[model samples]
Target: MKKYHFIAALLFCSILLQAQERYFLNSDTRLYTSTSTSAEFLGYFKYGAEVQLLSKNENGWYKVKADNLSEGYVPEKFVGTRLNAADIKTVDNENPVLAGGDQYYGGNHLFVLVAGLKARALPDKTSKIKEILFTGDPVPVNYLPKNQDEWVNIGGNFDYENAKFTLRKFIGKRPDFNTLIKEFDKLNPDAIAERKTVAERIVELAWNSDYSKLAPAYQRYSEVVKQLNDPKLIADTELNVSIAKGLDKHKLPEQIVAFTQKTEFILKGIKTKSLFLTQKELVKTFGKPAKTASIGDECGVYLSDLFYYYPDLEVSVDEKQNKAEIVKVFINENNKMILNANSVLDNTITEKAFIEKYGTYITASIKAPHSYSLQFEDSEFRIEFKDGKLFFIEIFFYC
Candidate 1:
């Protein structure tokens, strides 16, 4: 009875151990103090040694507790299931499977079309050429295994040499070959799906001129409509096919064209009128006149009478108040052509030339002995006189 009890206890322990998953330490594998190859190598465990899985590290190493009470890390690839004989037979009978689909063999070069041929980096289809021979550019190809199509088998390695040979023919003198290869390597499942979605939308919008109905799929009607109205889309056969045959009957195409034209016109107008006004314009419209001085040179101040409210007086100069005022004036001196009082006839006078020829129109009442200040529309001009002859004129304007 004692021997039977001991045997029963041993059997129970064995069953409990078998219920837990076990890992076997294999050869050519060095155990690390931590779950990283850079960690100190403790030692190598012989093939078929038993280990219990504790946890996994992000670096593809597994931490395992050994039968000797030792703990170490080993590469996950070198660890095998410690299955029983029956389990091994079952696994051997079942063929190991891998996912396979369209495989990107690395070393393939990409050529962008430019001009009339494929160039290194432009978007003209006719100008681009692929390097395929010694006389041609040597291109490299990289495989993107993660971007495999549905039919592709996973876990399959690519023949890098063959891929390179195949892509060399497509490489031209274009220096973008390496960049294209790197991009190909970075291709993943998510990115491919996103690209497909965008391409599909583009095709759909190009075919259907009525983007108003496509609002659910596209957020910005104006932007998507503009893209659909692009000249390139109009020329695309896929876009034409995707669009409804009755698009012309609906007049959506014409509307899109008109809208695009209007938008372009508005943008161009804004650009053209960007530099029309400054703060100086406002100042000129409503600014006070500076002080001035009168020289005894019979100097007469001319103000524009066009915008002026006073129209009764031809020209009046008050020396006592030092104020030169004009009444019944349709044009202000800033807008009048005031030549030398002695040189030209008064009949040749015009409001447009007065401001252009003469300085500011308003002469202020405040004056010095030889100098006087005047206010033009928005500018202030200082007039200096020597013996009643106009000596100097200065005007200041700001941005």
Candidate 2:
């Protein structure tokens, strides 16, 4: 008798909660078997497809039934009130499947102004997180809903609220801040010096341009400045620091390892057995690095990796393979590493001697304000000359 009463109560609630008004899918949306994003995916509903609204959960997932009697859950953001195809705005050449009709309607660019913004698999808050985006990250906008401004469909992923952002409608090329950040990361000398230069440039730009009105934008800008000013250092153990100090005192090997396609070579009295030396071997030879840093976004999806800094060398390790693949030797005031048999790195080697020894390179260009880089064809080695002398020598795995 109690079980029957419970079943009756559920039926009564379901009938009361059922939506009477019609609703349509605002974008190409996926249907989940359950309310959770981890549930089985039923299928996708085309843009502007009419769906029967069942019930909406507290977390904004809508229980809906498709025309074919396919009952599943779709994000509430995707379900809109009676959408008309003609009323939607669109641009040419956008994907028809992702947009309404043959056009995409939205700003030309979507600039993320906040840090740690999570990209969702669906527009709803309960959807699976695809990636974490940072400040200045330009999200690729594929389609924007005309009815609501709550969520945006970027490629396939979605960002919540769309509050901490700005949109631009220009067709011309714009300054890519993210690319500039990547270039700033690749700057020579050290992370501290590189960040100092970048931070100063950011301040100059911010001061010159019109400031954002949003409070969150101001907060994010402050955070970026703070991060650049106070760069995080790799927490090295005391024993590791001691080992690095001891390794620096030793006299480096005098042999010149030709900067060729060969992976195995002796560098600074330490021998590399393969394209990448294991962390164990690196620690044994050069000791653990003083600071470890990343070159790109924290998610590291595209052009991103880590660099471990020792006393006079920067070691870039491949995260996938867990080995030190790229080694950069910085020739400082003390002349840390000698290169090419007798060529010293302390701004004393002549250009004629460099050309006579290494021969002509495939390309030579100015890399920085006062630095020049030379790259050889069919080789993984690159040499940067500062003050008309060899400054930085880098070698990495070709692949």
Candidate 3:
């Protein structure tokens, strides 16, 4: 038997905001004729202005009916459901050093700021813009949000986690759950603590509400179990293909398969306190970048040609403070790889394979030739396909 629960009533908050779907402009935002900035400049929306949402493309760009009743594409950064910076709640900032006018990242934390935004002195809506930061800026954080995912206080400046501006991953294939679990049973727990984390995350996602996400979640759950037993479980494709062939397609399999990705990312982010990054670790890994960039008001470093090679990595720092504040790894066509930081993936895989590796991306409504973006509280992923081939995969890591 399947358990069903209706969340449409709870979703009314979003529904009431728009008769259809609607969004707000965070700044005096521009609207383009299409997704590219080089396209025609349709017009601009005033700060805090609301616009009717027409459609959202696979790459996370929005096609909106602007104030003048014109339609065009707007990047997701300047457009959001929230009206102001003050909407994000911040942890107490009583550090005496902050009062002394010293602005340095805590060195213990790194955050990826998802929007190209203006930094405000306070987290309140009325605060003046201190500076502007472009989308994908790896920001150093003084404090991490306790349990919520929507807001981040970065370097004493407040930034909201915008849908387009955060960390994301591109989609590939999904792993079949049938054989994967048999492998799961074969492995022993690496650590009691990690096993506990996995169990807890499982409990957290067990609700039957979004079975669309649940089935894929179960697939991921198995992957995590295998990883804990053998760090390279997914890396061994010979073993993985065999595992997939054995997966059972039972009732409510979608909900069951969709289980583990959240747990994997959350545990990774929380347990590591931060993951494989810091100002020093980045420089040490890739050396000083080949070039420097100034997007909006923030300084960023491009380790390479970006659109050409290794598009997956982004590192930005606050040079004055000599701190590496932003770190990102976006997997796109320019830097396609079989083995990512966590799993091995390629184009031949289905949406299911992708869900296990990167969680849900290409939604049921999106398919070949169209793109879609999935927003997480801390990160975002965009999946794009064309001519029946998957070409883009992007991920941003924000804490």
Candidate 4:
């Protein structure tokens, strides 16, 4: 009896240790290093490779168990915590089946589109997007016949209220739509079998922290931001802070800033296009009037609203002798404000060609005889024209 009790106690302790253990974000982008410097690149973890956390350093470095069964110290900023069993189980149960037609049902499973003409989650409007089906597009369905609207044998276990909430976002409020619900009794066994396969795949990928299988996740994330069509959703300081925190976990604050800036720009462009705001409107909302007047064929007030709503708005204008030549604006704050309303309007109309190429979310620009310059935060791209023909194109980014 004493020996059996001791063994039982040992097993309980092992279980506790396993539960407390944390896994690293198994990804290709995370590079393991022996020393905290660019010169040290010990090895790269294959996509979805998880490591056990051992310890941490004051400089945001972490000691972890690499895949080769070796212990090493890696930059804390590049490591992400692994998903646990509960998270994996939840995703597994919620996985959806892929089928033809906008709406299909299988044994208590039902999916509906609340908005947009076609059901899809791709950047472009096509039915072949391969990402995990979310509320926005690539809706999952089961039970309903391919040709008919009526459904039978929907097999999903999602709560009815939660399912309704998700369904309403895509289909909108409608009394007739609500009446479409019916009891699912004769579930297609084949569909259930397929669903299990999908569920297993989702669980396996999610549990293993395997992101490599999802091609271009970041780019797809960008596309999702665009599809949501709400700048406020992506522009919030909390989102930026959250991203910063994620990067901070890996100890990459600089990368956090760059990613946030680029995402902000993309969101701004989407907002600008959605609103259809003209150049004049942009200036009225954010630009400050010119202080000095210069009268010349090539002389004009160079304005910019890049820093309108930011915490610190930096604007500068430089002219050669008495003629206007250059204008630039820099926004250093995290919040939204009317940064460059007037200058953007003037420039948009005056340099239509440039607006077509650079977009209204312009951060910087320079004008010289036969020369033009443009800059997006942390990114420099130049286009040169000679004898009415484009001559050179250069693009680069700085960390």
Candidate 5:
């Protein structure tokens, strides 16, 4: 008889959850433009507000429509077919979920930002402490204040040992419970200790091998050292110092700094020297180019031809009859160039040093991950940086 009652209750719940039914927002819910948490937010629906359930997706997001004809998506866990009146709590106006009522309606998922935060029985700082929350701990939104305080009600009997902050329900993916906790446990003392042990093991291996001779071993060491110096883990100064000292004994080759002398490059000033030489002069100085390309109506009015050297140099030229005067120059890596006597414009220069030397640039654009192109106040000169170091440069001239 009890089994039959249980089955009947399940069927009743399913019927209530059918699409097109009137559903109530279980928590402060957000209507996103799409199913992703990272998508543009349309608006928020207050808790217990009625919404029309259009449908649900495989990822557990509900297609919902509000009374105002506004339609968007909300997470499956943030809505319900029926409301439990007992779940409602009194509103406090002093602290909001986020400051200044900026809290969205559907902020059902949140992660701990600080190291130690207290979970309370009520939405007040003076409320009874249920438990302590730690950094990176993912918590389900229980009740957000409709009044005005930052305090959140996490409910009673939160099982921290067996908590499952599954991403599928939250972020629509899997890291499993154990793995997710490990990721959240970044600041956990044991986890930090484990990382330190692994880093030390890598250092020991790098020390044993002839890093200078084996390129692969040296590359591995360089990667490990980079991670060891990561900002988040830099707090471990003793380990960092010890590992750095161990690796410094190797004394690998350093980048050769070129073009140390200062030379003024006045962008708006008169052109005293030309970056590009005439076709006749180019061949005379560097012999015949490795390749040549003709540019006409298809390219643009300005560029007539391009001359490429054996390696990292390209020269654009304008031709009339048998003579072609250089119009632009592009160079990459290992070049003799000076932005001013104080700053060396070369591949070996770091991005910080470049900016410090040049003051400010007009426009900056992302070329790729960790790569950027910066154009100064003068459009004729464009510089590109990759991996935080100078990558290439382009200088344009009409002559």
Candidate 6:
């Protein structure tokens, strides 16, 4: 009798929970039609979206409804009971730069743009751009802030910081101010001139640390001072003493690797157009690509197992011996961002020199007794040089 009652109670609780199922977005995920990722994309569910759980598919997906009445299936793991946005950790949110002044900076790194930025050859604003730092890149650099001008060095280029960080979007207090100051003090430079320069660099970091906090439309208004002011580092113990008074331990966000998007390079270092997707994932992402020989991309797609065409992007899947797999993708000139950061596609350097900068490429092939082409797997990138200078690049994918 007790066993029978327990079973009955368990069944009732399961039914009640099922009737009122609720789920919260733990991370950003795409809503799909079926349980597999290759399913049709319904829409994007951002972090902290509240959703109503309907039922589970046998393939480990949860059917849910958003407030907009849009229904779709999302992966089970990315959904949870909590809709806490604070728990979502990203790199920029962690170790946020804190209080910076002309003499001190909280954060110490420079983040460049995603589409590559030109590094000016000199400190002056009108100086020529010397190098391009690819987009979403951060340089391991310390700044030397002077007056209203802010500069960043990318491969000998002294570019303006304002170009990228126009407003205070992710600025905050640095978490390691005390430690940095202590380390600076410990650096015992021998000469007075060297000591002064080193000390100035340290102070400049702290001063520029809080620079990213500006939100107002930045103004470069000319100033007229009524009286000449001393432009030296005049020390005042009373004013300087308060800086260490109320500083609470600034905390950093938890470190986490972000999820990759479909367009991202799957391999860590070797950058190609390959996505490592199946036929379903490919269709879901690129929509229907030119497949049959009768209907094909103007550029053509008969040789490969399957081909996809976009003006800026082209993909070709390798045909396995028997099994159908998409391991490799070929990229054309449409999306040049595939050229990794700092790896500019310029005819300024020889193929050998470019390979030196990137290290030994995927592989090297001998085209003739004296000449040869560098390659990796079938889907790897190829570098072609003309008159000893790089001329063109081609890439293919191999799953």
User: Highest lDDT, which number?
Assistant: 2
Could you give candidate 1's per-residue lDDT for residues 220-271 as a string of tens digits? 2223334456664333322222222222223333442332231110111121
Candidate 3's clash total is 45
Please provide TM-scores, in order, for all candidate models, with all chains considered together. Answer: 0.17, 0.28, 0.25, 0.17, 0.31, 0.20
Model 6 per-residue lDDT tens digits across residues 1-399: 565455335434434554565566666566677788887765444454555677865577888754323457878877787656467622223222211232332223434322224554333335456555432233433221211233322221112222222112212232243454454456554344444433433333433333221111011000101011223222211112122111112112121011111233422233434334454454555556554322333544224545455432345544352112332332233222233344454435554454444432222211121122333333334444555554444444343
Better of 2 and 4 by TM-score: 2
lDDT of 3: 0.39
What are the C-alpha RMSDs, in order, of all predicted structures?
A: 31.0, 17.4, 22.8, 23.1, 18.0, 24.9
Residue 389 in candidate 2, Cα distance off native in Å: 3.6
Task: List runs of model 4 lying over 4 Å from the truth.
Answer: 1-18, 29-33, 82-399
Candidate 6: list runs displaced more than 4 Å. Answer: 1-275, 278-287, 294-304, 309-353, 362-381, 384-399
Candidate 3: tens digits of C-alpha lDDT, residues 2-99: 11112222223323536555567665446677788778664434354566677755386888754323457777766677765564322223221111
Question: Where does model 5 exceed 4 Å of error?
Answer: 1-272, 296-301, 321-334, 362-380, 385-389, 395-399
Give the per-residue lDDT digits (tens) of candidate 5, residues 104-125: 2233344444323566443234
Query: Between 1 and 2, whose TM-score is larger?
Result: 2
lDDT of each: 0.33, 0.46, 0.39, 0.32, 0.43, 0.38
Candidate with top TM-score is 5
Better of 1 and 6 by TM-score: 6
Q: What's the candidate order when arranged by decreasing lDDT?
A: 2, 5, 3, 6, 1, 4
Worst 10 residues of 6 by lDDT: 217-226
